[model samples]
Target: MPDSSTHPTISSAFPLNVLIQGEGFPILCLHGHPGSGRSMSVFTNALSLRFKTLAPDLRGYGRSQTVQNFEMPDHLIDLEALLDRHQIDQCLILGWSLGGILALELALRQLKRVSGLILVATAARPWGNHPPVTWQDNLYTGLASVFNRLNPGWRWNIDTFGQRSLYRYLIQQHTPETYQYLAREAMDAYLQTSRQATQALYKALNQGYNRLADLPKIQCPCLVLAGAGDRHITPASSQETADHLPNAEWRCYPNTAHLFPWEMPNQVLKDICDWIERNPEVISFKKPEVRSRGQ
Candidate 1:
């Protein structure tokens, strides 16, 4: 397993905690909303054996400093600064859920710098041509908040029947041990995430954060992995994203949900490794040089 200890550093004037391990071509792993860098341990630990992995706890999540009010642009700036500070000219990105959306944005902004993209259980445009935020969505968010407040650590507390039921429903296709482990880690990260940050991100998503039209702008190789049983971001949505990309492949895992990476770690690892091996050029792709004002 990759070292769980995260080193704190300043990026874009904001304190961020990042987990860096192994040594090879870089792979940046971005976790989903209400999740920290630790949430990506399953993929990071396995990938670290062959490639350097950098998983950062995004702003207002995990050990990173919290911001009262912010938008998606702030996160983009932070990511760019992180890459600059690390002196990484190019790297592959593995993004899950909300992180996948950010990955697309980063790839668009830094066309050459982002060598490849691995989008898991996410969509370029969440809700897929429908209204961004519906009443059901609002109700779901409200209920989640109320549940979090009413039963602290309920998601991971499997001793009680209620907790176990909720855990099983939210996280499917997991063994008893895997369920316990993932639930605990996910709950811990969720507890640390700032509620304000969650709301801000939700608001941003509601404000028409669609990237279907922008998918063609990202010309790098992309692998879209989706879970057939995913309810949050349906497989259809993921397929749409893959279809729009100029160069992309799609794969759907059966009997898996949004947390499929954790449920089927070995398969996901093999798929990613195989894809990277097939696309050797991702490591050697050169970034376009920026000439000074008087070149």
Candidate 2:
């Protein structure tokens, strides 16, 4: 960890509650659903030696500005505003789960701004459509899907999400302490926020378009991470997406589940560091876009 005595939070930048820490190459970190920028602060801090990290609590989550009507576009707007506030034209992106979806969207819209990608525990399509997952994963996902339609915030409860059936399937690698810490952090993110906006944000992820065809157009080097025991996105989903990216390396850690940043911090850092060291081209100040034939 890189000097963690002080808690860093910024409220004046583009109305976004951001955690700006470290001092090195800029790298934007994105957290998953039902999570806030605080959840990924440890991971970002670990990388502080090699990169300056800026993580924003997306609209309606954490201490960030509450959103009344949230959607995918809203997140994109937030990201652009954040980059503009910093006057960052291009930089590396580290997106976990839902954040990966938005990163992909931003990459397509502004390819010039993406120097590289670090996608973790994400899929090319919606969670429901992922393959090679247990029936238990599918069942809970199905129930959550239907419930989200009627009440998008039904899964916001810590008790409900911590149920043995659902909790066991999401993260298999944990201890009494780690589990408790993660559970509390997860609940705290939604403790104070707009339920309507958060629900809409959760629902919007499922409506994303197919991006498999666009993967090859990414010009920068990429690293796709997966957990062999990931029950949510599934290892197969990550593998499939990695296969499409023209310049990418796929690494799936054994016995790990979702939330690799917390479960396997050292391993995550090592792999990311190694990838960055090997691919200096990804860190170039200006990486040209790769125009597909049709475009």
Write down the TM-score of every candidate.
0.81, 0.77
What is the alpha-carbon lDDT of model 2 when measured against the actual structure? 0.70
Cα TM-score of candidate 2: 0.77
The true-versus-predicted C-alpha distance at residue 281 of model 2, in Å, is 2.6
lDDT of 1: 0.77
How many clashing residue pairs, candidate 1? 0
Candidate 2 per-residue C-alpha lDDT over 124-177 given as tens digits, one digit per residue, 9 for 90 to 100: 664543246577765765554344344433445323433334555555664443
Q: After superposing candidate 2, which stretches have Cα over 4 Å from the reference?
A: 1-14, 128-165, 180-184, 205-208, 287-295
lDDT of each: 0.77, 0.70
Model 1, 1-295: lDDT tens digits are 0111222233445656899999899999999977989888888888898889999998889988575776666677778788988999999999999899889988887877899999998998775222355565555544543454455434433333423343343446645545544555677787898976787788887787777987888888899998887777888999999999999989999887778887788898899888888887766657577899987
Best by TM-score: 1
